[model samples]
Target chain A: MLSCEQATRLTSERQERSLTLRENTELKMHLFICSGCREFGRQMDALRSLIRRQPGDKPPED
Target chain B: MIPDSDIADLRRDMLAFARLQISDPHLAEDAVQEALAGALKNAAAFARKASLKTWVFAILRNKIADLLRSKYREPVTTTDPDCKHCAPADDQYFDDNGHWQQDTQPRSWGDTHWLADNADFWKVFDACLNDLPAEQARVFMMREFIELTGPEICATLELSSSNLHVLLHRARLRLRACLSGQWFGTEESA
Candidate 1:
């Protein structure tokens, strides 16, 4: 299993589309065994979805 | 004369780009207007260093920073009630026994659609972005939403590549943690 630090690093790098195949495989392996990191990945995906949904020029309502 | 259609198209594109950098919609509108005006006024000085889009974004970034600096002379507070339970000690939410607490029935990845239909999801998302330290937030916005390359971000922000990476990493980590808390009810683990 990957250490938390390694998993976190992979999580961040995943967003950049910069991870190698070997690195991605390793991250997936680690994620299978690490619930915390898996949860982290889910949250990251959720946040990405939310950010993408943000309207660029709509005013915030009072 | 520039056709009215072209002008409107430019305004729309600039507003979309500015929205990526500045999460606040009104601020994005203002930045887009200012950037469009600047680009027009300085049309003679287009030195071809980058694409027009990149150049326009650089202007928008500066304008957003100036607005943020003015509006937030004091640090913005980070007290959203929705995220109060996401503290580090709240790992119980993700613990083995507690995992089933919230409709724990596992669903296929494609089956989940809450974020798509829920407006509150974005409120929490924007709140998390706003929680980031100003500089970190700026770097994150420039790199991720605006899709600027690392070297470009470093050059634009006057930061070293390593510094830029570190800031981006921290910002992403924080956003991940914050969003997990708000969406998944999971506290950051170590």
Candidate 2:
């Protein structure tokens, strides 16, 4: 199983590129048992959501 | 037909947007003015397929891109800030060889308490972003707000893939920590 730090690295990495099958499998397995890294992933998603809704999120007119 | 009110709104929003990317108030205003003027010149060509806001923003994005390219015309040495937020220091979040630290693990911020819509939330958001190192923030905005891809960012910024990745990671880490402290500090309310 990947350490929390390594798992987190892969988590951030996935944002820029898709993980390979082996990497994906390892991360998933790690997350299954690791709540901290899981939470870290959730935080990353929350951050993205917040970023997308930033001042320049969409082009207004909604 | 573009309404006068809409143009005014666009100018205000674009100014705020440009200010985030470019530190110079004068240059930021210049970018907005130029974008607005370009839109005016192309008024007849606008097909209205997209919202006027979207169309104008697209033009502004191009203008910002041009400005960035010009400013970085030299063989760019990207300023990769030494992140104070990454590993070793982050050991509390994990254990030796990399297992989660369990007791120090993060909790899910499932409901971010309307931060996605609150105007004040954006203020904090912008402040947090502005707190990052200039170059890190620049790369971040281009990737996140401007939605530029990795290759495009690398080509434009003269960064290697690893450099971009690390810079991006640190940027994300810093932003997350700031928001979690300022916005999500103690809120678990649904």
Top DockQ: which candidate number?
A: 2
**Candidate 1 backbone clash number:** 0
Candidate 1: tens digits of C-alpha lDDT, residues A35-57 = 66676566567556645443323
- Candidate with top TM-score is 2
Screening candidate 2 with a backbone cut-off below 3 angstroms (N, C-alpha, C), the clashing residue pairs are A3-B98, A4-B98
lDDT for each residue of candidate 2 in B9-67, tens digit (9 for 90 to 100) = 77998998888766678988998998788666656566452345556776787777777
iRMSD (1 decimal) for each model: 10.5, 5.4
- Model 1 RMSD, rounded to 1 decimal: 11.7
Full-model lDDT, candidate 2:
0.70
Poorest lDDT segment (10 consecutive residues) of candidate 1 chain B? B100-109
Q: Can you tell me the DockQ of model 1?
A: 0.13
| lDDT scores in order | 0.58, 0.70
Docking class of 2: acceptable
| Candidate 1 Cα deviation (angstroms), residue A42 | 2.6
Backbone N/Cα/C clashes per model:
0, 2
